[model samples]
Target: MPRTERPRAPARAWFTGPGFAPAPDPAADPAGPRLVCFGYAGGTPSVFRDWADGVGPGVTVVPVLLPGRGLRSEEAPYTEMAELARDATEALVAAGHAAPGARHVFFGHSMGALLAYEVACALRDRGLSGPRHLFVSGSRAPHLYGGPDGQDLGDDALRQLVRDLGALRPDDRVGSAYLERRLPVLRADLALCARYRWRPRRPLGCPMTAFSADRDPIALPAQVEAWRAYTAASLLHRRVRGGHFFLHGPARLPLLRELRAELTRTAEEREPSWTH
Candidate 1:
């Protein structure tokens, strides 16, 4: 008999749906510079939920919740970088966050950094105004997509990598139950990174900043520095203390300070002539 084949799965969105989640506070300024964020693999928007508190007033932190996790847990996750970028761009535009002349910024950590870069590029390609600044944290330059591979790792290796990346505490339980619940999603994200192929494109006009941890093994210094080629504007690399997930540790304070400073600067630059 001929070999049997399984049917292809239906396409599922990575976002909750056609809309974005509500801002942290109901009274937040609707027109302020929006800091749209994408989290690392197997990560949720909750990781950035508290950013608004540190950023204070004027800037709103809009964390983009990827599907197959968080509130959209029932949906299937995206296995390709382009798919994720397209979904994010559509969601941002549909939610009115990318309106012309609106002040906007993008911040992505680890895997999110790559996604954010693509989103910025996608918006620019569509003839839409891009962000004021792009902040990419804990990720290598997009051109090095074919770096080390982790997609084919077995379950044990996959869990180990996550733990090594600081996603899991040493004391926390890591029985089959935990792995069973988290590994699949993480594996999908790794696959996306592994299979990614960065196509050459015009450098973005927006200023780009790359954040890296001094000791991060994955996003090494050289890899971080490679981000310079992606932007036509200035490219600055700032380092903090910790490993891959430094943003959640001691580096948190300084990271927020930098973010706030950029937000403030952008807002000031865009101020109306009458206000001066």
Candidate 2:
């Protein structure tokens, strides 16, 4: 008798739904450059609430919303770096955010920085156009990615770890109802980072800007500077004053100012000129 072939499983749909929110400005220019943002572990899109208007006009701020948070709170959160990166890349393509000739920049903090880097790599591997500029904040280079084993700790211990890292205010109780509610999500996010293993690839072609905070224990200046090796294009390392969560405090204004300046330059470069 001839051998029979077995049925194959259906391909997984990586593009589940829209992965990002619209620009904050209702009247934002459709043709303007986009500033795509991704936040830290267990963070919601609200982290970038003020960025839309803060970056000024001519740029649209689009925040990437991860699962298990905000409106996506019902969805199961991703706990693997590769799977999340693949899904995010598919979502961006389906949403037309990564279309050829589209001008956009990627900004991510902490765990978000790793996601942004992986997504950018995925796009390149698929022969898709990647971000015009890559902005990684409060994260080490992909190869050097490792953190405290917070994911393995108990609920109480994990809560205390985050609080000590400045994720919670000094006065905020570790057992607060709000923190308790987000604890699981935070654990899963931390696990995603812990399990990541870096693979070598060609350096990214787009320019990169890395931000390091003076008081950030997690991502030191040396670690942030290591990002230079991952990009063939120019790398600009900006050392700012504050802790790991500086983007949320008084230091945010100056950071935004610098970001605005860069975005303005990018917009001007992309503008079509008419020669008379």
Candidate 3:
């Protein structure tokens, strides 16, 4: 006999504040792990638009939308790392993303890696639930984050730096009016990085995974490995191919697969086993 399709689970309605874009239907797996992703400087939630499918149905993908971009474009962008972290923490809490017993994880790239770490600290300070695992990609550990100081560079110089970092392709360089409009936001983000200062704090309790790209000059493998200092739990460092923005290319699939496996393992460990 032909089998009948099972009924779909009802979606859980959750608040997604200004700091985040809504996740896909939570009903897909209401109790599954949630993967909160933060993108690089001048990046938007759209960068992770296809991530839900990448991570599979067992995990919900939530991409953060920082102010001064996307729908929040009219709002002033934050220029201080601490302030952004505090506000991001509050936004996550308000949306139930940081509720006690919630199973969630975090993934961030470059500037976003720093932001994600700060947010995790903020949550812990408030006595809230932190991520099950913290994934940082293409960034130096917080204490060692000195920079090229692009915030003060002239528009031409700043654009050149972005190009040098492979953030801007050669073909997209000529006559791109959109790039000109985004420079301010990019500068503001750089200012956040330049002005950041890491203070001594207790190491976080969650395990961490640091992903470094072989060709990424800014965040070398050694710098990525330094993330071990921030977490008391185990640190797994994975090296992949491509440049700083490796997540945007061929490397992204394998990265997502690793994330899916990790998230699934964490969820299984959290579940209570039944004794026969």
Candidate 4:
């Protein structure tokens, strides 16, 4: 019989797991607050790749890379929001950013918003420090996840749904092919979101900001406003001008300004010497 050899794993696999994947810019300042970000369904950390420059150098934008995508493509995707949140919390600890006095913020988009909220809760439940602020974009309230959605659509319907959400275009052959390869992961994430049961817990102490598109079907103005109930502190809702994927291109500047301003406020509060 011919000898069979197992393929070797990628060199960076060790650092590319859930929550700990490398951000576009890995620069660190022990005193600077960390902005941990989560992407939409089936999204990679690349969603926030260009955000670091826009956010300025005072805050470190850490775009989380979930499993079963990007560098961890070989790994299985998570099917539950709680499990994902727990893993995110552990990943932060493993990365040494969860230490005492560490200032951190969280930002999540669409399905990522739900994951970020749960993660903040998980951190608080564990007696660990939580983010100073939570920014949720393009998602409804967590408790409203029980709404009916087509998580088991046929191939054509699924593709149509993807197209409707602006993830696919009529003329982008390569992009279409890439989305086809990612459909399974996308379906799993959608199923998880549809089936999520929001467990009632004490509202988080951290303030929250919800960003919604002026006309997003997935998340209407009322749905986004409902997120205020999850936070005991102040909750600000901002309406941007675009559809569901508004944060993708030039439409992202307004949200960036909010992130930068809030981060600057936190920095100045912590250390008055922090330059504006």
Backbone clashes for every candidate come to 1, 0, 0, 0
lDDT of 4 by residue, 130-177 (tens): 888899999999988964565789878887877777765346543367
Q: Against the unseen true structure, what C-alpha lDDT does each candidate score?
A: 0.77, 0.79, 0.79, 0.77
Give TM per candidate.
0.86, 0.85, 0.86, 0.86
lDDT of 4: 0.77
Which portions of model 1 show Cα errors greater than 4 Å? 1-30, 169-171, 176-179, 266-276
lDDT of 3 by residue, 90-194 (tens): 777766666677678999999999999999999998889999789999998999875656889998888887777777644667237767767888999989998
Candidate 3 Cα misplacement greater than 4 A, ranges = 1-30, 169-171, 266-276
Candidate 4 local Cα displacement, residue 110, angstroms:
0.5
Candidate 1 lDDT over residue span 4-94, tens digit each: 4422222223324323344233465555778888899877666676787787777767788776776667767778898779878877776
How well does candidate 3 match the true structure in TM-score terms? Answer: 0.86
Candidate 1 local Cα displacement, residue 149, angstroms: 2.6
